[model samples]
Target: MRTVLHGRPLAARPRRQLRDHGDVHQDRLAATFADRCEPYRGYGAGAFTILRKIRQGTPWKEAAGSAFNGQGSCGNGAAMRIAPLGAYFADDPKTVTTQAIRASEVTHQHPEGVMGGLAVAHAAAVAAKARLTGTPPPDLLGSVLDHLEDSFVRKGIEKARRIQTAEEAAYVLGNGSRVTAQDTVPFTLWVAARHLGDYRAAITTCVQAGGDVDTTAAIVGGIIATPPREWRDEREPLPDWVRR
Candidate 1:
């Protein structure tokens, strides 16, 4: 969120609670990937199905949405579920962020939404780098305002910093009830930054913010799960397989 909007460091970096590292985050991501499919509303669920099949080593192309013509586009959905990729890679954020967009193209074709994915992925990737490097996270709003393209999502991200609390950001910007990047991504980024060091807190705060609970939580979880410094070493390990 900050990377796209502000492009600087976080204001008051949140305290991190190291726990459930390793495979837990990745497995949860796979589950979220599947959960988003249950409703399967036209375009919402198609990307994951394609993603799973593709990851299985299939050279697949074509998605289930209409945003970037036939090329597909950006959507908050891509931004939301990409944390596991960031964590899995842990060091190479660009690769993970790229993968996040690829995940988005399977469904969203909208440029704004695609940009949302990129922003979220970049945050996650950066978070991973911070976790490994022991560097404190930057001011999130500044980061987003600086990196992300000027769009509805970008505007909303700027608003997030002013809103003080996470609840306020979600209320004013959006909690993703509409599912567009404009409606959801900014708030998700806010939540991620607000809880940068604490994975569980970040996710719970998303739930408190309401609207698109899982999606918002997932986005926040992805960002906070990996924060600046080697916090993971202090946390509990995640399960190899998620109940999802």
Candidate 2:
């Protein structure tokens, strides 16, 4: 919401949003994410560091590049929030890919982390196009994989293609247990692919898989589902800034 309202380039919006509102925990839902949980009160560790630097007026590239002893972070943090960006560029796959990388670079400079965001963004873009056509993507994961370069994240997604069940996917591909993009994006994409038309089912599968449930559910939900009204009613209203 801040991104759209700021009227800035997509690549520039995340840094400003983080600087101004990164630590606000507005969700009223019952979740155990540390950032959203009491006492922690901010983004995950990787994002927190980047946000701190951004708040200090550090450039996005420098802030991101400085993390984890200069290797940057490969955490799923970048991927978790990128589905909307993919949908925004739904008609342009190339832009979706490029912008996703730029967006991730604000807080995740590691190639795996950037690739995770790329994959999820592309998945959301494909799903958005599918929604417009009123036909589900015949090979959603494959479509996302086509846009990705070689990486463990890509390999994990390939492994996702061979899995038949969510439980099996969570077991083999991991259920965001490691909090890395390599561990999380593949399984979330698998769920999104299998339950693209069923928002409730997609979220249920994420919760049942259990590890990093909030992030996994957020990624899948951003791709293929909007929460039902009943579910929405249980959560806090969107902030005024988001509404604007």
After superposition, the stretches of candidate 1 with alpha carbons farther than 4 Å from their true spots are 1-62, 65-74, 87-99, 226-244
For candidate 2, the TM-score is 0.83
The lDDT values for all models are 0.58, 0.75
Per-residue CA lDDT of candidate 1, range 1-244, in tens?
A: 2211110011001101012332223233333443333332333444555545445544333333433455454556567655555555556555555555555544456778777866776777667777788886678667556657778878888888787877578779899788777888888888777777777677678778778776676577667764434544554443233211
Q: TM-score of each candidate?
A: 0.63, 0.83
Candidate 2 lDDT over residue span 89-143, tens digit each: 7888987877678667666889999999999999999999999999889999999
Evaluated with TM-score, which candidate comes out highest?
2
* lDDT winner: 2
